[model samples]
Target: MSFEILFLVIYFVAMAGIGVWAMKRGKQDAEGFLLGGRSLGPGVTALRLQSSSMSGYMFIGAGSMGYTQGYFSMWYALGDLGGGILNLSVLGRRMRKLSQILGSITSIEYLEHRYPSKWIRLIAAPVALFCMFFYVLAQFIAGGRGLEMVSGVSFPVALAIAIGVIVLYTFLGGYLAVAYTDFVQAIIMVVGMVWILVATLMAVGGFTKGNEAVGEINPNLLTMWGADLGYQGQWGVILGALLVFSIGYMGWPHVVVSHMAMKKPSVARTAGVYSLIFNLLFIPGPYLVGMFALILLPNLANPETAIFEVADAVLPTFAVGIVMAAIMAAIMSTADALLLQAGTIASQDIYARFINRKMNDAQMVWVSRITVLALAIIGYAIAAFDPPAVAAVVIFSTTVLGSAFVPSYICAVWWKKANAVGAISSMIAGTLVSVLWQVSGAPDATGIDPMVTGILASTAAMIIGSLASQKSHPVPEHIGRALDETAKIGPIPKKMLIDQDALLASQAEMAGRHE
Candidate 1:
């Protein structure tokens, strides 16, 4: 085998080995399988969150944007960089505290507990699954294309191999495996990205020369408004580009589950700091490399392949293998997370909650695994035959998911009166508005993006829906108490905000106090 192929084999073997080890550690309990028993440390949590959040979108989609749109793509990167910090700071600590207090293993379960509604899971679960499927589909595309390039295999064979590896690791180890593997992948992603950036810069004689070359080809490519000045004076599109990734990820169910998997509530503070550091190192590299590729490989037919093509073009034989692994790392890290979350919802929220209420922990674990396998098959089929634009799929799904859930998720911990009606209404309205806005091409006509309009409609729906129904559907007393304790961060005696390490006495004390 060539060094590239050999290196890829070694990388795949290592990932599967980690899955086996993690399986032994995590065991088969529902909590262990689904949430890693909430034992992730700050560093692990931070990198895992970032790795899963960036996904193939950063590797393929972001590069494509930069290759085509030039410096304008930087707006999305800025939003993405800020989004990580914002997610950790805004939802991190409180979400960790509240989800545990409510005994939620899944993000959807947390919504049901906080809002106190069966309908919440019934409706929310499907919406989440639908949105996440699109996200995972993007991964499948990126992975297949990456594998096809590296292995020189047909697309079908490459896609199956890629999917198989992701599913195996996720199937064996569950959340613990995914988290640790994500940490490893996050390091690889940044290193590979920086490697390509350095090589590209050297080839082009540095950033200044690269820009000058791009300018000579077309001065518009050097402009922040995008090639041909496509977005000039379109401040609405500009704001949307910045806001979409920055605030949008806060609403992603797959991403926020990292908050629930944290070892403790206080970990969020350190995780936020870690995120800031990682973002600065990694976020801008892909876009910068993509723009540089415009000068180097101007005739590149597939813009999404800019980074991969750059690595292949610039790196030596062994180093090329390393970059290929990094691209796979980007794809697999997020693919596993999406698979796990979708499976968790399918099994815990729908199968157990609705189909078989009395199932035990072991049964739940099996159901989750089975659900994951089923999803992989369906996702593979869709990806193989009718692939949509990876970037478009990611943006559309994330926009809708963020719009649908951001208001409800933020309100869950922060607002006392955020009733089920409000959450449900917000989810429905946000999804509809975002979809309609995208489908109807209202964003094109109005010069505003779907994210801005969808979030606005959803936020309004939440406030109006909750206030109008306060008398009819007040926040349950139990959840209200949990929210209060979650909010009351200071003055708690012992191991900080209602610690998990403490004995059952504290829990009972709160129960008695409530009664």
Candidate 2:
């Protein structure tokens, strides 16, 4: 077998080994299987979060974009960094706390609880399912493309191998296995990226030579500015991407699931900071590799394959094999997480809540595992058949979450007047506006991001709806209790720790206080 084929086989075996090992460790119950028994520490959480966030897009698409667009692609890293910083400082703690308060092991549950809207929950269920499935589809597609690129195999053959490896580990081991494996993959990704960058740079005689090479071909490609970039090449695009990406962190079911696995709010808080540190490496990797490719190989048949072409040109056979494995690792790390989140939401939110809430923990665990396989198969089929607009797919999902939930979440955290009517109105309006904006081709026409438009409209709906329904219902005391539990800084006050019994007791105490 060629080195590439050999590496592919080894990568598949190693991923399967992780699944088998995690299963042997007895992650049998729902909590154990789904959230790693709620025991992930700062380091594990940080690495897992970073790897999952980068997904296939950072490894493949961003690299391609960087190579094609030059320094314009670096703006993506800056945007992600800004988002990470804001999420840690502003939204991270609140989300962790609210997840606990609502007993929300899933993003759908969190949205439902925050809004107290049945319609919101109902609508969000299918949206989460579709959104995550599509996200997973992208991963599968990228994995297939990456494999086919390196190995010169048929796309279907490569996709099947990639999908099989991911499904075997994810279905058997669940989130615990995924997180641990993601950490391993994260290290591999960092090493692979740095190794390739260094080798590529040395071959080109450093940044100065690299820039001259690119400038000799196309002068604009050597600089931060570009012809088609418009405001996108400017600081506004950077800041907008950062702001949009950062605010949407709470919306991604996979990322939010990481927070739910934390044993305590403090753990999530610490992990938030740690997440940023690891992300520093991943966020910049594409820029370095992409920019380097631009400088080295100024012309290509397809810009998206720039990384692979560069690897083929500069790296030895053995090194190319390693980098190919690293790319596969990135795709698997992300695909498993996406698959897990989709399965969890499908089982917990849709199946368990509406279909059958009485599912035992063991039964639920089995269902979730089954859902993992089902979702992965769906992802694979889509990957095999469908081609999508990659950036649009990501932005569409983010916009769905942002417009539908951000207003309600913000109000739930900060505004006492936010009620169910407001929450429901915001979601319906937000989702519609976003969908319409996307369908209307507004993003292409006005150069305004669809997310910004939908969010603005949704925010207005939430505020107006809340004010109009002010007399309907006041903020529940449980929301305040949830907030206190999340913040984890106040005294172990009476309002916190609100189980069913504690809720009754708090109500009685409040009644007495009124008397």
Candidate 3:
């Protein structure tokens, strides 16, 4: 008990230390603070990107899934192992190049710049905030529940403690702080996962023995059909599980911000390699740990805490502290990024774009900090009053965010015909379909995941809407040029990346100019 408490205290101090270090580095200007002056090293960028997207999903949700559904949970892990690198390889360079061309500091700003639509920012910003808020709430729930169990405190107090620590550090440091701290937390998570997995394998007499034991308990646990063959013929469910993490990262505003924060467009390639290596090492450990626990600790009350319980059973008291701290660290790392991106979009995308366009650096920072506080309050209220399972909230939020923006984001640099009408149509249709599909319980009924349906709806909207409205809403000349540059093979000349016209183009009229 004392060890867990001590490690928790130590972890908080370390995060604060990183925050203070970031503050002292003197990148307090709005641009520097928001995007780390677009100067992240490849390693930091890779890990921060992965860590932000990985979140409590891996620590809590993935384990819970493995423990409950058995081998089917590996489908998510397989997709996740490549999601980060896939995102970087496809969008990293293009987004970095395009965002710099348009002077976009936020992902919402990047969309508006690419599609040349004020409505895109107006619509996308709110949807992003709405989705990301739920995401942060999931992290809060995961952390709060963990703390509650470890500290024997009331849920409200434990939640307050978790959110309080995360909020304090976030308030102190800006983007760099979030990135560096996630980088550090990613390292801790990898080490702890590897340590715990090895311990589990040893305890169960090896992977083969462990699986045999699980099969003896329930033969279905060893199959890809999920425990009891519940999803025996549900290919749609299986596909959704795979696609959720794979392509979802490309569309998430919070995760994609890492692209815009790269030091240069060329950093994307190196970052991709780093991402894949990290993913390969860390992505499957939690699920495997959870699956093996079907034999070792078969009676856990909450499957979400499978890793924690397994650690407590297998590891020494000190190692148990480190292991739980790693899970909490993952929760906090992801929460920090979500808060930073949500705050960035709220202050820069919505506020500056519409409400107060002339704010200075200090004012932007102040507004952002306040916005972070507001989001934390909103998330706390939602989570404290009616918290759902971490996995459910994460999947719904991921589906909405991914569906709402995936097609538009991909088309921003890739499709020359992508215009304002199409982007707006895509965003609205995607979000509407995603929400309706989930609410209607279509996934269980029809076996089609909201993510698949949402992406399909959004992509079709982007294609059909842009084509139908081409004469009235052709892509702006400057944005087309930006897209051309982004599509090129190698490092683009700096002069070509950012031009005055691209920077100052009026969002209201850029797409409508040709008409």
Candidate of highest lDDT: 1
Q: Go through the candidates in order and give each one's C-alpha lDDT.
A: 0.80, 0.67, 0.78
Ranking by lDDT: 1, 3, 2
lDDT of 3 by residue, 269-299 (tens): 5566677887887787888888988888899
Write model 2 residue lDDT over 132-197, tens digit each, in one string: 776777777777777778767887887887778778757554433543466676677777777787
Backbone clashes, each candidate: 0, 2, 0
Residue lDDT tens for model 1, 473-496: 999898887888778544545434
Query: Which residue segments of model 2 deviate by more than 4 Å?
Result: 14-45, 101-103, 173-180, 222-227, 232-240, 254-271, 361-374, 377-381, 480-515
Per-prediction TM-score to the true structure, in the order listed: 0.86, 0.83, 0.86
Model 3 per-residue lDDT at 514: 39
| lDDT for predicted candidate 3 compared with the true structure | 0.78
Residue pairs with clashing backbones, model 1: none
